[model samples]
Target: MTGRSQTEDLARLFAPYESLAATLLGRWDGSIAEGDGSHDRSHLMRVWQLVRRIARGEPAADMEVLVVATLFHDCVAVEKNSPQRAMASRLSADVARRLLDGIGWQPARIEAVAHAIEAHSFSAGIAPRSTEAAILRDADRLDALGALGIARVFYIAGRLGTQLYDPDDPMAERRPLDDRRFALDHFETKLFLLSAGLVTPTGQEIGRQRTALMRAFVEDFGEEIAMPEDLALAD
Candidate 1:
């Protein structure tokens, strides 16, 4: 099959699975907190879209595993700093396995899906052993870096009553970077570094673009907040 035809075929095969996963997650209709807007069904679908795009560049990636993993990656949604956060991926993976079994997915495919889901979380500290797992991990992380990522940082902070920044040191230059205390600190501590660790070439390219956009925003923000004397002194 020509490359275009193969991609079209793959998309057709995964479309139903994506719909089923979305339907299942929609029923949950839950969030981590009352005001939490990130990590919802919308987030899942966005990551799934990324998975499809990234998978296109990775011929070795298992589309089935990637689709199932992406859908369930955040199905269990724990707070970022919760003690249970590290295990959230595993819990989601277990739930995914059960769901896949109910749909008559073969044990091997189910296992592949579970493993991909389990290894997709940044907090899980598990290296992806398969291309599908790597794609899922990269896709999910991609969603946490660009314009949407900036909004999510502030959204979660607002939900937790955290400050937008430390006026004296927005970049946390002298103090430790505490994203929990200041939303802007997240750019320094995590967002800027994601591009380096992205597993797939396609993901890395997208990560670079998003990271650049975020960096520009931070620079502009710092300039906007600088005291007139500070700008004059630099001049």
Candidate 2:
């Protein structure tokens, strides 16, 4: 198939899945998915929006791969602490492949999507290859910024029973998550690192600005913790 034809074919394949994206995210449905709310379907949608927005501005972007990769990046949940974390990541890719195949997507398209999904996980440690992969990865990180990012942090924290912040216990461990460790540690580890790790130029710029926003929020949080009564000082 010609390049444009291939792109159009992929778009056709993805149209049905695009419609079902909202239905798959049961947690973000009513009142934040009835869970701690970490990354829900709405989170997936936001990443999709960011990916498309960034992709549209790039002349060389392969929008199909970005769409597929973003959709399946978190098809399965990562365990906070499990020897099976890798297994979970792999399962997500497998699920993506199956769905893509079921939709009559080309084998090559499915492979590209699966590869991107496999590497999108923070713990996966796999480098992205195509432009689509890079954009999707950066888009996912963008979800960790702004007010939505803040809500997700606390939501996941509440799920794990972790406090919002505690300067006494520094973040040292390198695992998924558990109830004990404070959620703020996430900022120190993944969130802070994400901005610098973006692969695309658009992603890098947006990540930098968003990271600054998140950092400022963290700093304000620290200030509030130091003196909750003097709220006006933060302003």
Candidate 3:
């Protein structure tokens, strides 16, 4: 097959995945409360972009499995610290399986997609066993870093009535880091450590850069809010 024809064929094969994503997103629109913007349709789409990029770097990655998994990875969004947080991915996997079965996806393909979704969440604590699952996990975590990650942190914190930082101990020098109370605590608790957990080399490189950006912002923020005593202590 010619290069152009191969490209066309690939596009034709991928079109339905994109269509299903859009259809599901339309149904999800406005169903979530305004404050839950962090896990909205846009987030899923961004993760899809990363999944494509990461999949390109993995010769054995199953694109169809990755695409379907990315679309429904967060089909059922829950609060960060909710009691059901760990079950979110499993619920989403079930939803994706039912939806894929309805659309006549092969049993093997549906199982692949379901496993990828089930293993994608940080809270779920399930290790990814497939290339597609690993890519999905890395893609989702990548969104929780960099400038966009900064915006999401504050957005969710504001919605939950959390402070920007702990006034007395912004870096939590004397206390345990609690992201539920201060947005900045999230950097120390989670965001800064994501790169180490990434499975793909492409994702790890991107994650390293984004993590640095988050670290720089945290340093700048600390400087901006430093008290005389804090500055003196640093000296």
The lDDT of each candidate is 0.78, 0.66, 0.79
User: Candidate 1 on 126-211: residue-level lDDT in tens?
Assistant: 98888888899898899998899888888888887889999878877798998888989989888898788898999999999999
Taking the tens digit of each residue's C-alpha lDDT, what string does model 3 give over 99-131? Answer: 777778899989899989998888888999888
lDDT of 2 at 101: 73
Candidate number with greatest lDDT:
3
Show the lowest summed lDDT stretch of 10 residues, model 2: 25-34
Count residue pairs with overlapping backbones in model 3: 0
lDDT of 1: 0.78
Off by over 4 Å in 2: 1-36, 167-180, 227-235
lDDT of 3: 0.79
Task: Count clashing residue pairs per candidate.
Answer: 0, 1, 0
Could you arrange the candidates by lDDT from highest to lowest? 3, 1, 2
For model 2, state the Cα shift of residue 124 in Å.
0.6
Residue range 34-151, candidate 2, lDDT tens digits = 1325665466557777887778767787666666577667656665666676665567778777766766889988888887777776777788887777777778778877677777
Record all residue pairs in model 2 with backbone atoms less than 3 Å apart, i.e. clashing.
Answer: 27-33
- Which pairs clash inside model 3? none
The ten-residue window of minimal lDDT in model 1 covers 26-35
